[model samples]
Target: MNEKIKNFADSISPLIFLDFLFESRKNLTRLIIYFVISLGLIITVFFMQLSYSDSSRAGVINAFFIIICTSSALIGGTYSAASITSEKEKKTLTLLRMSGISGVQIIIGKIVSGFIYMLALSLPYLVLTLLLTLFGDFNFFRLAGGLFMWAGFTFFYLAAGVLISVLFKKNASANSFFYFSMFTLHFLISLLDEWFYRPLYDYSSYKFFTNLSPIDVWVNFSSSHLYGSTYYGNDGISSLFNGTVPDYAVITLLYILFSIILTLFAANIFEKYLRWRED
Candidate 1:
């Protein structure tokens, strides 16, 4: 059992280490650009809040910041996806294959690196968001819960992106697939909501659709409107009422579950689909 655990750890470590080495290359450039853009936007929002009469200016500003973090996560996935596909293009994937690393390791490493890079690039803005919320009289637990919700969504996006990276050999092809997947998921949910969940929406149909989509689960985790969503309870920050909401402990665990499922799903596909061409 110990040996099995060690081997499993060994497989993922090199990929994680490689990410650190590769960090000096393309990721550095992305880190700089993302930081500059994110910080600049946060500052702009902060200054703009000075002119607003509403004391809830902090809520408005934090919402704006959270939106930016969400956007950064999306963009981060794109960059991470592109990074892997570009390696495939450069023929380095073959070398990694020959080096005794499995596809699982490669994918896991890529996910870890991408997640870390994103956390690093966005942490400052996130801290700033929290700090402003603190001064702005926002609920501490609420703000913290929202950030955890964001991380869950981030993992989902990153896994989907890595899956796309593995499936497509070209950068454009991979990106196109990513966007198509995004659109399809969004479009289907929209249809379900408008046609089924709207005026006369039924609980049965809502459960069916939401079950198939962790994205909906993610949406329910963040949006107060969606907390009482038909399928799931918004017990966390998603709770609409001023009742006793669940703490970050519960929210974080749920998010981690979603992230683990997505990551494992990606790894499974990477092993099942790509092994042939890679070998």
Candidate 2:
């Protein structure tokens, strides 16, 4: 038992160390750039639009920007997958493979690096959201809820992107595939909501659509002001968008489960064909 425990710890240590080293080497600069640019744009827009806005509408806009920042972090994982593919293209994957690093270690190390970098990139946005709470429109509970939802949903999307990268030979192809998958998901949901949900729920169309979109879970959850309001959009499964907060625990659990299952799935596929893939 002791030997098993030690072996497990030994196994994880190198991946964690590699993840940290890689993050320190490359991702710090990337995080700094993303944070500076995104925060600057958001702050500038908020101030520029402050004088023209009504308070209620301004709060909604703030929430929207917060969601955008959180959602954009999903791209970090996609970028990390491309970085792995680039290494594969350069034949460096062989070195890593030969170094006694298990396939699980490789995938998880890369995923952790990407996750850490994304959280760093998104810290500025979280701070900004906290600052908004001081204005009375945003509360602590709401802010926390939003962050939880955002991170959870981002995990799901990030896993999807990584899965695509594992399946594709080229980084460019992986990126295109991920984007196409995202677009198709949103489009199909929107179309189904518009064409089917609206006709069924009348005012309940919003809840159905939001439930379908794991991404919207946090955005809608923070929108206490939107509760009890009627959603007129054409979508199926009404009852969630009338400003009612869905079961956040269930949604969050679903997101976590989604990430784990997909990551395992990607790892399985990688282990099977990773050796045979041509650079």
Candidate 3:
């Protein structure tokens, strides 16, 4: 078991290390820009929190979750999409392949590298939020759960970006498609839920569709878990899983499952693309 674990780590470490080096070498300026933006946002939120009343601080904390989720999703998606598309643009993918790096390795490495990069980008916000919980009337469990949800959402977006990158040859095209699809899906599904589904369908259906948006999931989860609200409790969806699960739990599970499926699909697409190129 130890030997197998060691072998797996050995296989992945090189790709992860090399990808980070490549990103630092090629995208250092962009990374610095993002880091500066994140730092500015964190500082702004900190001052805002200082002025909020005790009751309003919860709302501020909730806003932190949304900000993190949105920024991480957007940044992570762009980087993940560019990671592959840039390689193809520079024709480095072919060299990597010739150097005996498998397509699966490249895909997994890109995903992991993007995830790590986003996590680093989010660390400041995460730390500030945690510090806020010390003085605010916040539920620790809810804060932890929301962070977990954000991480899952980030993975899902990054995987989708990878899939998009595989489908497009140019970084610009892949990036455009990723951002458009992400915003479109979130807004379109949300509008459908609010305008058509909730007014016409049952709570279960409304809840399912609403939870499809990671932002909505985080908001609803924070409301129910932290504020002791019945926003999701009255819904019959909870009973479907033996009444032990919350809506966010179900949503997190679905996001994770979809992330795995999308990553596999991207890997398959990449392998096929490589074969076509060889031919």
TM-score for each of the candidates: 0.70, 0.70, 0.83
What tens-digit string does per-residue lDDT give for candidate 2 at 1-279?
A: 999868755765776677657666776787667767988866875565445434553365447545654455446656655755666677777777777766666676667666665676666666655555554354555556566666776676667777787777798888887777776665455566566656664655345555555445444454433453323223423234453434553466677888899889887887776656533
Give the number of colliding residue pairs in candidate 3: 0
Candidate 2 Cα misplacement greater than 4 A, ranges: 1-65, 68-74, 134-138, 193-210, 214-219, 225-249, 275-279
TM-score, structure 2 vs. true: 0.70
Quick one: best lDDT, which candidate?
A: 3
lDDT of each residue in 9-78, candidate 1, tens digit only: 8887877766766775756786678778878877777676656643455456436445644664567668
Q: Is candidate 2 or candidate 3 better by lDDT?
A: 3
Ten contiguous residues with the weakest lDDT in model 1: 226-235
| Tens-digit lDDT track of model 3 for 1-279 | 999768766776787888778767788898789778878877787787876775566666767777888887788899888888888888887887886767777888889888887787788888778767776666777677778778888898889999999999899999999989988777666675566655564734555565577666776766765466534633435567765666776777788899999999999889888888889
For candidate 2, which ten residues in a row score worst on lDDT? 229-238
